[model samples]
Target chain A: MGIEHDTLVAISKSWGLFYLIALAIAATAYALWPSNAKRFEHAKNSILDDDDKPLK
Target chain B: MPQRADAAALSYRDCVSAKIKCLRYYRQQKKRVSRDRVSLLFMGDNDMISQLTSTERQYALVILVLMSLCGLVMAAGGRGDPLGVHGFVVLAFSVGLAFVLISGFYAPQPDPEQQTQYYDDPTKVGIALTMAWAVFGMFFGVWVASLLAWPDLTFDQAWSSFGRMRPVHTTGVIFGFGGNALIATSFHVLQRTSRARLSDQLSPWFVLFGFNLFCVLAVSGYFMGITQSKEYAEPEWYADIWLVIVWIVYFAIYLRTLARRKEPHIYVANWYYMAFILVVAVLHIVNNLAVPISFGSAKSYSLFSGVQDAMTQWWYGHNAVAFFLTAGFLGMMYYYLPKHAGRPIYSYRLSIISFWGITFFYMWAGSHHLHYTALPQWVQTLGMSFSAMLLVPSWASAGNALATLNGAWHKVRDDATLRFMMVAAVFYGIATFEGSFMAMRPVNALSHYTDWTVGHVHAGTLGWNSMIVFGAFYALVPWLWKRESMYSPKLVEVHFWLALAGAVVYVFAMWNSGIIQGLMWRTYTENGVLAYSFLDSVEAMHPYYIARAFGGLLFLTGTIICSYNIWMTVRAGKALATDNDAEGDIPVFARNAVQAGE
Candidate 1:
C-alpha cells in the first residue's frame, strides 16, 4: 500500500519509454500494411445492404 | 477408373465454389430479414451461420495484425519485465490466428436448398446459467457476512467463512451470472436486429471461452491472494491482458456484425452497448497501467504517482461502475423492455440524449470518490457538479423504460419478467438519486468511509443490475429454448418478492448503520477530544452486519428457487415452436422480407 517517491518516479519513466516505442511501431505497421480493395468493397456492401432498396 | 476419379475430383471443386456462393446469398438474406420488422427474430440463427463467410474475413485479419504488432512492440521494448506482456501477446496471437484459420478452412457453404436450422438456443442456456449463479452468489455473500460478524468462527465453518469466498460471491453474480447472461442475450438480439449471423464460429467461442476463463482465474486468484490489490481490477497483470484481448475481439465482432446489419439505422440498444464497450476499454487500459515485476511474480507497480495515481485509479474504478455496470445494463434495458412490452422505444431522441449525457458526466464524477482527500479542491468541486448532473440522464433513461410500459400495467401482474424490469428501473432511479446526494461535499464528510457507500453500491449492483439481469433471463431463456412457459411461474413470483425484500432490508440497515457511524465518528467530547473509539463504530455495525447476512440468505434462497425453476423449464417444459404466444408477439425481421420482395 505504501510506495517510495523515488521508486514511483522510476516506474513512470519506464512507462513513458514503453509508450513511445509502442506508438512508433504502431505507426510503422499502419504504413506497411497492405490495402485490399476487395475487402473494402465487402465491408461497404455489408453496411449499405438495404440502403439501395426502396422503402416499403 | 482413372477417368471417373478425375471427374469426381472436378465435381468436388465445383461443389466448394457453389457453397461459397450459397453462403453469400444467406448473408444477403440475413440482411433482408433484419430490415423486415416481422422476420428479425427468425433471422438470428441464419445470420450466425453466414458469419463464417470470406466476406467478413478482413475484420478478423485486421484484428490479428494489430494484436501481433502490439505484441512485437512490447517484446522489442524489453522493459526488463516483458514476460507478462509477452505472454499476453502470444495468447492474443493464438486466438486471432485460430479465428482466421477457422474462417478460411470452414468458408461458409451457402445452402442452395435454403433450409434454416435453429438449435443450441443461447438465450435459454444464458438464462439458466444467470439464475443459477445469482443464487450461488447470494448464498456465498451470506456466508461471508456471517464470518465477518462472528470473529470466533473458523474457516472450517462452511457457511460462516468470510475470508476466502467474498470475491466468489461478487464475481459469481457480476461476471459469471450477470455478465454471461448479458453477452448471451445481446448476441441473440444483435444478430436478430442486424439480420446477420455471427461472423465466425471461432469468435463466439472465443468470447464465451475467454470470459469464463477470466472468471475462473479471477476467483481462484482471489483465494490464492494473487491480486494487484486494486478493487475490481483485482486480477493481476496476466488476467488483465487476457481481458484486454477478449474485449478487443468482442468489439471487433460487434462492429463487423453491425456492418452486415440489414437495418438502415442502428437501434438504440446497440448504441448503449457500444458506449459500454468503448468506455470500458478506455477505463480498463488507463486504470491498469502497471508493470509486473516479472511474468511469474505476483507483484506489480501502478505507473501513476501520488495524487495522480489516486485520481487515475478512482477514475477507472468509478467508471467501471458507470460503463460496465450501469451503461451495459442500460443497453439491456433498451432491448428487453421494448421487446417484452411489444412496443417501440418511448423516444429514440430521449435515448440519444441520455446516452451522451451519461458518457460526458460520468467521467468527471470519478473524482468525487476522493472527496476531502489530498485531491485538489477544484477537482472535487467538478466531480460533485458532474455527479449532480448525472442524475438528469440516469433518470431520463429510467423514465424512458418506465414510460414504455404505459397502458400495459396488466402485463406486470401476469409476467414476472416485466415486473422485474419495471422494478429495476425504479431501483435505478433510487440508486442514482442516492449517488448524487452522497457526492455533495458536506454529505460526503459524514458518508465517506462509512457503511453508507456499501449500501449505495448494493442498491446499484444488487437492486438495479441483478433485477434487470433476472428479468432479461426470464424473458430470454424461454424464447431462446423455444419453451412455451416456465416450469413454475409461482417460483418466479416468489423469487422476485423475496429478493426485493431482502435487498430493501439489506440496504436500509446498512444505510442506518453507515449514517450512525459517520455521525459518531464526527462527534466530539466537550474538550474537543474524539468522543468514540473506532471500536465503538465497529460494535455499532455488528447488528447491521448480522441483519445483512440474514437478508442475503433470503435473497440467496430466492435465487436458488428461481434457478431450479428455469432449469426445470428448459428440461421438462414443452417448447414453443415460434415466438408467437398469448403475450404480445412481434417478430424482429418481417420488415426486411417486405423490402426484399418489393
Candidate 2:
C-alpha cells in the first residue's frame, strides 16, 4: 500500500516547527547567558597561543 | 641533551649552557624512560614510521595483513566481475603498505617524550596529499568543463565518457582534496585549541590513509562504471562498509582527544568540526542504505525508491553540502582567519549562534531540492521558509569572520595569504545568499536544472571552500615545516588574482547562459504555445560553455602554480627550529621546559 501523505504532512508542519523553535531559543540562551561571558572571552584568545619551540 | 640547528651559530659558552639547560629539562620530566633520553631531544623531522614504537609498528602491519587477506578472499571469490578488479586493487594497496612497514620495522623505537609534543606527522603528509589531490582533481575539473563545450574532446572510450569522468572530478575535488584539508587542519586545530596530543598515534594514520582508500575506490569505481547511482555517495557497498569502519575510528579518535582536552570549554571551531563528522556519519549511513544483489556482484538496489528516495537523496545531498562543504570549511575559517590576522574572532557568542542556527535550519532545507516535484506542496514551502531563514546564520558566520578584520585591515592589504581568507569570507556571504535565493519556488522555476545550479555550486566550492583551504595551507606550511614563510609571496599573489578571475568569469558566464535558457524555455508565443525547442536552448549555451571552460583552465593553472610553489618550499626553503606565532604551549611540561631557560 501507498503511504498516508496527509497525516505525515500534518505532523511535519506542526511538530517540526515547534521543535526547531524551542531548540533555537535554548541554543541562543546558552550562547548569550550573562554568567558565561567570561568563559567565552577567554576561549576567544586561547587558540592564538604559540606552540612550544624545539627544546633549546 | 642534544644539538640544535642554532647551536652551530651560537658562541661556544652559550651552546654549552643551552645544552645543559635542555638536559636539565629532560631530567626533570618523570615520564621519560632512560632509553628515551637522547632520542627525545632528536625528534626533528624523522621519517613517519621511525616515530612509532616497535609494538605500534607491528600492530599496523597486522591490521594491514588482515585487510590484505580480506582483499585476497574477495579476489578469489568475486572472480570474473568488476568486484574482482576492486579486490585486486585493495590487495595491492595493502601489500604495498605492508612492504613499506616491514622495511621500516627495524628502525629505533620513538621516544616516549613524544607525548609532550603534538603529533604532526599525519598532518604533514596530509598536507602534501591535499596538494596532490588539488592538482589531480582540478585537472579533471578543467577537462570535464572543456568536454561540456567541445563534447567530442575525450578519448574514444567509455571510461573517458562524461558519465564516468564527472564523478571522478567531483569525488576527486570534494573527497580527495577538500577532505584531506579538513582532516589535516582538524588535527592541527584540535591539538592547539585543546592543548593535548592526539588520543593515540596509530589511529590518526588509520583515519587519514583509510579515508584516502575510500576516495581511491570511489573514483576508480566510476572509471569502471560501477556505482549505486547516488550523487556524492557513489561508491559501491563494499567501499561504503569500509568507510563506516574508518569513520568510526575517526569519531572515536576525535572524542578521545576531546576527553583529554586541557580546556574547560570545547572551542567553537571544534563544535563545527564535531558537527561535520557526526552529521556526515548519520547522513552517509542513511543515504547509502542499499542491498547488494549478491556477495560477489558489484550491483545493488537502494532501500528507498520513488519520491521517498528522491527526498532521501536530496536530504543527503544538500546536507553533504551543509556539513561536509560548509561546516568543515567553517571550522577552518574560524581557526585560520583570526590566526592569520592576529585578531580574535569578532564575537564568540555569534559563532555559537551561527553554529546552532545552521545545524538546525539546514536539515529541513533539503526538501527545497525537491520543489515543484511530485512531493507535496507544503513540504516545499517549509523547505523554502527554512532555507530563507538559513541565510541569517550563514551570513552571521561570514560577517563575524569579516568583522574580525577590523583592526587587521592593513594585514589584508599587505599579506596575500591573509587576503585569500578575507576574500573567502566575502564569497561565503555571497554564496549562502545565492543558495537561499535559489531555494525559493519562483527562483527555482528559473534556476533549478540550469547552469545556474552549477554556477551556485562552483560559487561555493571555488570561491569559498578552495579559497579558504589555500589560505590555511599558506599559513600552515611554514609553521608545520618550521620555515620562516612560503617559498614565494609573489607567487601567492599571482595565485590569488588568478583564482579570483576564474571564479568571476565562470560564474558570470553561467549566470548569463542559465537565465537565457530559463527565459527561453518559459516564454510563450502569441497564441500561447511553448516558444523554444530544447535544441534552441542548447544552442544558446554553446558560447558560454566555452567561456566557462576557459575560466576553469585559469583556476586549474592557479592550482598547478600553488602545487609547484609548495613543492619548492619543501625542497629549498630555509629551515628553522620553531615558529613564534604564539607564546608556545601552555601545557605543564612545556611551561616547565620554558622556565628551564635553555
Candidate 3:
C-alpha cells in the first residue's frame, strides 16, 4: 500500500522524469561495469591503430 | 700501414673526400623523395597510384567537350544583356569544369596496381570547397553586418541588397562551408571508426557535387528574389527536389559503408551521424511540400497556409539546427576531440545515453519554437517539457567531452587544436542551456522577436560550430598533406585568440542589444501607452550593430589567417623536402608516419 497521487501532473512529475533518469543511470552502470572495460577500450583504440593512414 | 712521412696528409684527404660523397648522395635521395611526395599529394596515397581505365578516360573527355559546348552557348546567347546573371554564372561554371576535366585527364598517372583502395578524391575536393566557401561566406557575413551598421552600403543594387545577400551569407556558411565540412569529415571519420572504406566511390562524388549544385541554385535564386519565404528552407521547389535526390544517395552510401564495418559495436559517433542524415532527410522533405508554378520557373507556393504553415516552418527550422548544425557537428566533436586529446572517451556509457536522449528529445523540442502561437496548448507544454529534459543529454555529451580531457589538460593548454575543441564543447554547453530556458513561455515572451535569439544562434554557430571546425581542419591538414605539423603553431595561437575575442564580443553585444530591445518593446508609460516607439528601439540598436560588425571583422580576419595557414602548410611541406634542414621542419605527425604513437 504505497501512497497514491494519481493526477496527470503528479503522475508525470513522479514517473516521467524518474523513468528516464533511471534508464540513463542503468545504461551508465552497465557500461562502467568491470566486464565491459575491454570492449570500450578496444573501441577507443581502434581509431589510433590506423592513425598513420588516411581513414580511407 | 706504410708509415710514410705524408701519412697524416693522405688520411685527411681521404676523410674529406668520403664526407663530400656522402653529402652528395644524401641530397639526391632527398630530391627523389620530394618529387614522389609532390606526385602523391596530387593523386592520393600509394593505393591510388594507378592510371585511369579506358572508360574513365573516355568519360573525362566527353564531359570536357560537353562543358566547352555549354559554355560557348551560354556566353553567346547572353552577350551584352543586362539581365544575364544566370547565363554568366552558368557559362563561368561550365568553363571551370572544362578546365578541371582537361587537367585531370592530362595529369600523369602511375601504372595500374593489382587492387585499388578507397577513393579519397571526393573528400579532398570536399575539403577544398569547404575552405573556399568559408572565406566567401564570412566575407558576405561581414558585409551584411556592415550593412546593419550603415544602411547606405546597399549601393541601391537589387543583387547586393541586404535582404538578398543575408541568405547568401547564411546558406553560404551553413550549406556551403558547414555542409561541405560535415560531408568531408563524415566520410573520413566514418571510414576510420567503422574500419571500412566508403562502399562506392561514385555515389559519394555524386552526393558532393549534387549538393553543391543545389547550393548554387539556392543562392542564385535568392539574388533573383526567388523564394517560397521559408527560413533556412528557402530553396525553390526544383532545388528542393534535387536535394531530396542527393540526400537519398547520401543515406544509401552511408548505410552501405556501415554495413561493411569491421567493428562489432557501432561507435557512438556513427550513431550521431546517422541521426543527422536520417532526420534531416525527413525534416527537409516534410517541410518543403509545395506546388511549383512551372517546370522552368523558380517559384512555388507552400502547400500549407496560416498557422499551420508557421508551425511547419518552425518545426523544420528548429530541427534544422538540431540535426543539420548540432548533430552532425557533435558527431565531429565526439570523434575528433578524443582523437586530438589522445584519450579514450571518459564514459562510453554516457555517450550512448546522450545520443538517445538528444535524438528522441530534439524532435519534440522543435515545437517549442511555435510557443505562444495559435498552436494547441498541450503541444506547447509537450515542447517545453522536452526542451527541459534535453538539458540532461546535452550536458551529458558536453560533460563527456570535458571529462575526457581530465588527464590531458596539459595538451589542451599547449595544443591550439585541442583548445579549439574544448572551447567548442564549453560553448555547446552554454548555448544548449540558453536554448532550454528560452523555450519556456515566460522567457520566450521577452526573448522572442529580439536580438537575444540572434545572440543565441551565433553563440552556437560562431562559438560551437566554427571553433570545432577549425580544430578539425588543423588536425586534418598536416595529415592530408603528409606534413609534420602546421605551417606555424604561432599563427594557430594567434587565430585562436582572434576567434575567441570575436565570438565573445559578438555574443555580448547581441545579448546587451537584445535585452534592451526586448525591455523597451514591453515598456509602457504610466498611462498604459507604449513608452518607446518601435523606431526608437531600432535607433537604440546602432551602437550594438556597429559592435557586432567589429566582432564579425575579427572573426573574418581569423578565418582568413586560417586559410592562409593551411595553404602555406601544404606549400611548406614541399619546401621542407627540398631545403637543407629548413627552420620549419616537418611536424612529428608527418615524420613519425602517425600522430601520437606508442
Candidates' chain B TM-scores in the order shown: 0.79, 0.90, 0.85
Number of the top candidate by TM-score?
2
lDDT agreement of model 1 with the native? 0.70
- The per-model DockQ list reads 0.03, 0.41, 0.19
lDDT of 2 by residue, B1-598 (tens): 3466455445455556656645654453334344343232222346578888898898999999998998988888789988888899899989988987887799998877677788888888788789889888888888888898888877788888999899999999999999999999998888778888888899999999899989988988999999888899899999999998998898898899999888888899998988999999999999999998988988889999999899999999999999999999999999988877777899999999999999989998999999889988888898899899999999999999999998888889999888999999999999999999999999999998899999999999999999999999998877776555788889999999999999999999999999898899999999999899989999999999999998888998898898878766655444432222233323221232333225
Taking chain A by itself, what TM-score does each prediction score? 0.43, 0.77, 0.61
How does each model score on lDDT?
0.70, 0.85, 0.78
Binned by DockQ into CAPRI classes (incorrect, acceptable, medium, high), candidate 2 is acceptable
Q: Which tens-of-lDDT digit does each residue in B1-598 have in candidate 1?
A: 9877777876676567556645654575456545643223323334443434454455555555565565555555533443434545454655655563454445566453221221223443445556656666776777777876887664565433454577777787777877777677677667655655555545765576567667766766666555676677777776687788888988887898788766666665777788888888888888888998754554688898888988998998889888888888998888777777666666555676687778767987998999988987867887898899899989999999888888888988788878999999999999999999999999999999998998999999878998898887777666554455667888889999998998998899889999999999999999999899999989989999999887778778777877777666655544333211222122222223322112
Give a tens-digit lDDT track for model 3, residues B317-427. Answer: 988999999899999998888877767788887887788788777887877888788887766887898999999999998899999999889989999998999999999
Better of 1 and 3 by lDDT: 3
Order by lDDT, highest first: 2, 3, 1
Runs in model 3 deviating more than 4 A are A1-37, A50-56, B1-99, B106-118, B574-598
What fraction of the native interface does candidate 1 get right in terms of contacts? 0.00
